[model samples]
Target: MRLQTAVLLALTLLVGAGVADRALAWPPDLMPADALPLKVALRAEAPAPKAKVSPVTGPAAACCAVLELRQYTLKPGQRDALIDLFDRYFRTGQEAAGLRVVGQFRDLDDPDRFVWLRGFPDMSARATGLAAFYGGPVWQAYREAANATMLDSDNVLLLRPAIAGSGFADVTPVPPPVMPSPAPLPPAPLPPGAPPAGHGMLVATLYYPFPAHDAAAAQDLADAFARDGAPVLVAAGGPVLAAFVTNPEPNNFPRLPVREGEAVFITFQAFADAAAYDRYRAHVGTPWWRGHVLKGAPEVRRLAPTSGSRWQGPF
Candidate 1:
């Protein structure tokens, strides 16, 4: 597990865009023509069935039981500028405001795009933390600068750990000045088109969508991934960091839009660079165990680091 959760929350600032651009389409190499159907309707039915909430309770798992997967499409060439501001100022202020800033990154395929994760102890904490940060002085001071770096900030997914032991590894905190300078991490000798692998670690986020109507199946699928699918991915080549199932908890703070009908199991894997990711892909689907465990192919999103990205700790 990695401790990228708390720093991301501060990066979500006050902004208004009529609409945000959707994530770049899944990569061609990853999305096969005969692959399992990838699209699901985004809206849940009215009078939506209540999503069950199961908050992880304990001292060790203090952050990120409930998380948000946030992606922002920045104005061309403005992604790094945002990351600089986030690392130097926003992350510290966000923590002070009581929000968890999970990990943040640059999208592998889209240079102008950024993605990050945020966590909450529970839904109520989410409301309070967000309210405190959004209404507090930190955001008010930097709102314009932060808003200017973006084109849209609306793409977000509310998620939870797929199973026990499914949160980020606790990385030691590196204060802004003491952290390493913004240089692309050395690339592992991976080939082109794998996840980006230059400055920092690359994370491959696999999204496995279940039938919108089958809530039980969604949990079952997540369970199966934890028991069977994860090992296969590791055996093939992925060094998995963590995996999570989408929480059914309705978004208490409706101010930020969430995907209503979608249900997915998400997995994270770290690679030295695109080449390492490609190596994992080479062995991923061909295994016999895959046919036994996976019911369908998943939608994949690979993220790499911007100059400002950081992943610390034992993980």
Candidate 2:
């Protein structure tokens, strides 16, 4: 299908499923003197189209223009508070300023961890948008509330989509929060076809010990998984989202910490639940993984989205 048609279909599904509603702006009164103008900075392209077949079954394509895999280590018992603040105050100003708030979630393995994703049309846009959001009014009003919930906000990886049709489908903007609430509620369940919670999406990051400085070598690795390895996992009943390869460009902003050194590749997939994950695990021992996807023994981690996560639509 055409990219535009696919995106429209994705948006319709999200809205019908009630995932399109949520807060998107920060308080408007607090714009900073030097902040980049929100309107100019937010010139983003339409989200990339979803693939007709599994990305793993084809060649690697650039997913989103630029993707950031971010993880925040919050204070103990503060994950919910942090997510509440984010849901209420972060999305609006951030997206308005230029960033695409892809999704937010609680780390299933780490109670104090909050993980989320956002995208940009390119690196230059990322730098501009982040600057505006940090320097803008919404953050000014709620910075303290937001900061109080986190102990660390430095775990981040800059990536590009690894396969054809690997990026997220276009989504409707999240509605602005209607009013401040005494407590933030968990984000609604994902729409039909999304991986279920107990056995929901398994977002895995594969950290390779060697530098993937060679473009050909990197493509080879990513393609191996996309074209060969991904099909094996799907046959086992796991639905794959997109896989990504780290972008080697130096961090444009010296401020935020993204892991440097070592090559990394990430995969997003989902199963029915824990039992389903186990079933996939049983298949992992097969030759394909040992000889291809995991042949190098990359560091792999699996994560599930927390209750307050807001990812609605075509994955």
Show model 1 residue runs off by greater than 4 Å. 1-62, 171-199, 287-297, 307-315
Cα lDDT over the full model 1:
0.55
Candidate lDDT scores, in order, read 0.55, 0.57
Q: Candidate 2 residues 53-102, lDDT tens each?
A: 22212222223668888888888877766666666568755766767776
Model 1, position 176: C-alpha lDDT score: 31
Could you tell me the lDDT of residue 305 within candidate 1? Answer: 56
lDDT measured at residue 52 in model 2 versus the true structure, 0 to 100: 31
Q: Give candidates' CA RMSD values in order.
A: 17.0, 13.6
Residue 43 lDDT in candidate 1: 31
- Considering summed lDDT, which 10 consecutive residues are worst modelled in model 1? 10-19
The TM-score between candidate 1 and the true structure equals: 0.66
Residues 1-315, model 1: lDDT tens digits: 111121111111000000011112222223447765232212333232221111111112224678888888899977766776666556656666566676677777888888887777688988877776666666666677778989988877888866554555432232332222242232233233323223535464554544553546666665655555655665565655556677788988887787766776676666667787788788888542353334466656677654333342112
